[model samples]
Target: MPAVTVDSTLELPRVPVPPAEGTRQRPVLSVTTAPRGFEGEGFPVHRAFAGVAQRDLDPFIHMDQMGEVEYAPGEPKGTPWHPHRGFETVTYMIDGEFEHADSHGGGGRITDGATQWMTAGSGILHIETPPEHLVLSGGLFHGIQLWVNLPRANKWNPPRYQSIEGGQATLLSSPDGGALVRLIAGDVAGHRGPGSTFTPITMIHATLRPGAQLVLPWRADFNALVYSLSGRGSVGEQGRPMEASQLAVLGGGDALSVAASARPDERTPDFDVLILGGRPIREPVAHYGPFVMNTREELVQAFEDFQAGKMGAIPAGKMPHTAPGEQRPV
Candidate 1:
């Protein structure tokens, strides 16, 4: 794998918002629980959302919350090389480190609070593995990976990569110092995230202090949902309380409010949440394992490309941390 860097002083463009003088009217539609499953070898995960049979979550096909579990020494595990096409992958680390390498000569590392956004346009093969040191020492490994679907027109665009450090994420706090919002993509409190996307979307990792309240604006047309990552919280006007690992699917509205429930004798009384959504693509989707295409023919073609060695290959045996660039199709 090779080191990928971004300009330290680069500025992300912000999404405009109207004045915030009036009351917000967002509503809670239903709540859903992400089923648990094993992925990438034996890594345990929670399937927060997916697009199966129908495009339930358009512009976004899948999301998985990697383990918050602790690994014992000599028990390391990770995903081996795999092929993908027609979408982008966003991996956000909450506590652990992950090294990634792709066939397009793109590679990087993302650790605690950092993010790796990879565009698997057309077709590409990649692998994600934990560092060997972690395997020996044993520690907590937690993170989230999202599959953002590209519009039909941009599905074949060239593959690209962006690596953002945890410090680079925009952090916005409430006026009363009760809540903190880490904007990874889209905008929050007029501050934009570093991620560049092909579709209109927003992703915010928020934490609210006990009994604290926060209001945030969102586009009316975007379908939205909030997942309680940790602690207990109430969402929308109904004050429906939810515990960690529960997801609240929200109805269309201009804005949303979230509050954490107070807990006595708790040292760190904070509720963590992941807020995500985007405008629906409303187009037909054909998916097969790692590949997602608008048609079955394209999906089959992706498999053919991989079998024909068009997606490139990872060198045999131990891979170097950095390697010479490989030629790829334009």
Candidate 2:
């Protein structure tokens, strides 16, 4: 008998392997009620997991949701030039426009449904404010800003920036057509997102129709959380319900299940949820004002550098327009 070799055309029956025990456990969700904090003088913001004890939200140091309030003409205010070091800043605009300028000669405009990710590796001075048109005419302003910490090894890396338009994001819809997820980073439904990240992280802006459900897979090592932006929703296997402006911290698990509440009397029929997670950095965090570093000495150096004009100043003139093809630095 001749030796038989599996032909290239041979199709083998595939068997699914069960996930390891303990790894497949459904996550537990706990609601975290974050208080309001003012930024840039008057901008009201809700900080998720605020305070030192809650710093367990690693990789993700801070998360802020800016005003859903409508600004009257000439009342729109924004942060002036400030310095940051040793981390990254992510800004997502839901409505209105934000003009930004950074020390690396990086400047651009992010409008509704757009995003800006800036890495202040060593240090960078930047300004983010509403454009003149919006400042004068006034309009609704709503957005989110997240601070992602960098490992100590990469804290002094060169600064970089990236901007992503809403259209460029990977949008995935559920099979039942009741849930939609806009992936800014990481993966969803086998589709990757547009943003580049130093660490493994997932950011998904999800919307669920009334009474709809979504079961999303997540890495077991990642620390995950769900933030309710609007309406109401239940998360995790325990069905922990959360309302608007609340944060749901999740425990170790491989998957998360979320469902939007059925509200007949509510004007908004859908629920908005922001799901974020990242692998822990597990390092010391020494932060002061806009600077975040692993040591107090490094934090001091950042301030000294900014005062000594190390971080270049924004040019005194009209805001420069971003050229085509310009992308955020990786």
lDDT scores in order: 0.77, 0.76
TM-score computed on alpha carbons, candidate 1: 0.87
Provide the clashing-pair count of each candidate structure: 0, 3
Estimate candidate 2's alpha-carbon lDDT, on a 0 to 1 scale: 0.76
Question: Model 2: clashing residue pairs?
Answer: 161-328, 161-329, 162-328
Q: What range of 10 consecutive residues in model 2 has the weakest lDDT sum? A: 1-10
Q: Compose the digit string of candidate 2's lDDT tens values, residues 1-330.
A: 000112321132211222455446456546777688878736778877675254558888888888776889998877757778899999988778889988787778987778899999988877788899998999888888999999988998899999988877776665566776778998754678899988779998887779977777787888888988778878886788888788888887787777899862274577888899899999999977888899898877877787777866666663533221221111
User: What TM-score would each prediction reach against the true structure?
Assistant: 0.87, 0.87
Regions of candidate 2 where Cα sits further than 4 Å from its true position: 1-26, 51-55, 264-267, 318-330
Worst 10 residues of 1 by lDDT: 1-10
- Residues 1-330, candidate 1: write the lDDT tens digits: 001222321133322333566646578876777788888767888888732323446778888988777899866577767888999999988877888888877777889888889999988888788888988987888888899988899899998888988888877766566776778898665678888888888988877778977778887888778888777789987888877777787877788888899871253467888898798888788877998899999988987888788876766543443232442221
Report the Cα lDDT for candidate 1.
Answer: 0.77
Report the number of backbone clashes for model 2.
3
